[model samples]
Target: MARSEEQFKKIRDQRYEEISNAALKIFARKGFAGTKISDITSSINLSHGLLYHYFKSKEEIYVALITNVLELFSQAVEEAESNNGTPYGKLRWLTELTFKGDFDVALDRHMLLMEAMQADFLSQDTKEQIIDQYTTALKGIGRIIAEGQQTGLFRDGDEMELAAYYISLSQGITLWNAKGLYPIRVSADMVLDPLMKRG
Candidate 1:
């Protein structure tokens, strides 16, 4: 009997996800330039040849990792949007949703992907794809902020600038914690305090 297309897709996705999860851990630990395909295969207890059946190279794995992170982040925002709230409330929900359990692991993977964006190992097309993904994510957040402003739920300001600032702030916190320069004692409430007070 032949496998159905849906079943094939399910198996393919499962294998890809396994490879990506292993790559995420290795990349987070050793960074993009330092990580090797062998490292990913070893982490998952798979032979290099079997790993290559799913991903051709480390660059492809890095791109897959970035794509996965963006999808997860987008899903987090979407889930937060479903909660009862005004636009500002939704934004707050989204911000807090990002820091929930296992988010630190995702954040670490995100930082390594960002570092890879600066490397020559990534092709120009891949770099552009990553940037486009980030820009789309930022614009999605900006749109929410704009909606809040229009509804008078959030204070008036340059929505794009505000969105960009928030993204930078989140990334800064991730980087700071990764460096061990700051303790992860801060709460989402502390980060949202200013926005809440202004609204």
Candidate 2:
């Protein structure tokens, strides 16, 4: 009839996630600086004090959001590398895995970028952290592309540039064609047809 320590921890983590999710929506609607603790609190009908019990500051919450996404990105890289398959196969897997999420409807890139650009409170270190993680992710993808090239499966181009283009194309499609063809199922032919190895 009593909750165990594990149960209590689960409940606490759930509540923390609830606050973060709600705050993100509000932050999206009204830029970060324009958002207030009260906005997040009122949106979730939680007291200001209660929210602070989980997060020390709004900046912390924003950082958590960024860190959360970065973790997902890292996972994608790990999953691709860990796959005991061909380079092309791994790249395809990465494509499907990365774009499988509901990113189009989840958050707006413009809003988040604007907030980051305008937030003076965002520390330089935080910006660097983001950049570093992003570069790592890119390299993971680039390595696969390079492997594919070495095996004569992919075209002869800059590995990093090709990887970046793949990401850019997927992002562009997801951002603009929210309800349209997405993940393109990460079809290998779509990539191969254009950038495949040529004799």
Candidate 3:
């Protein structure tokens, strides 16, 4: 019997995600320039034609992965901004959300973002899009920090700079977690400490 349209759609979505996961694994480790279509295909035991059916080229896969990661980051920041609570509470929520996942998978996603930021070979448009996303995230976080400062719950400083520090601290911890050199579960306090107001 022939598969229904819904079944075909489900299979397509599954294959697309599989290709994405396989591509992400390679892109995270090899960087876009170093990675090849064959690398991603073989990693998931997928054929070249099948992978192409989902993505046009290796660059397309890398771009898709980066775009998806940035979108998630943007959405999280937006959520924090819209959250009805104290700025400190919002920051805590964001911090917790960041660490609330598989450490290895989070590390991979973070690594890909880091590499993409430094990848000069990428199209100017793609680079600009990344910068735009970062700017948006920083602005959202900065708004939260600004509110916290108004309430005397956060330190006084440039809110944007504080936002950068906030994001950097979280990303640093992600990289550290993957090292396995130190077995410690990072808590939200560790991330919010620098921003939190003190007597």
Q: Which candidate is the best by TM-score?
A: 3
Per-candidate TM-scores read 0.80, 0.85, 0.96
lDDT tens string, model 3, 66-162? 8998899889999998999889889999999999988887888988988888888888888989878878888999999999999999999999999
Ranking by lDDT: 3, 2, 1
Report how far residue 21 has shifted in candidate 1, in Å.
1.6
**Steric clashes per prediction:** 0, 0, 0
Assess candidate 1 and give its lDDT: 0.74
Task: Find the candidate with the highest lDDT and give its number.
Answer: 3
Model 2 agreement with the true structure over 4-113: per-residue lDDT tens digits: 99999999999998997887777777778788999889887899888889999998988887677677777888789889999878977877765566664334543464
Over the full model, what C-alpha lDDT does candidate 3 score relative to the true structure? 0.89
Clash pairs (backbone) in predicted model 3:
none
RMSD of model 3 against the true structure: 1.0
Query: Which has the better lDDT: candidate 1, or candidate 3?
Result: 3
Runs in model 2 lying further than 4 Å from the true structure: 105-119, 179-194
Pick the winner on TM-score between candidates 2 and 3: 3
Worst 10 residues of 2 by lDDT: 105-114
**C-alpha local distance difference test of each model:** 0.74, 0.76, 0.89
Worst 10 residues of 1 by lDDT: 190-199
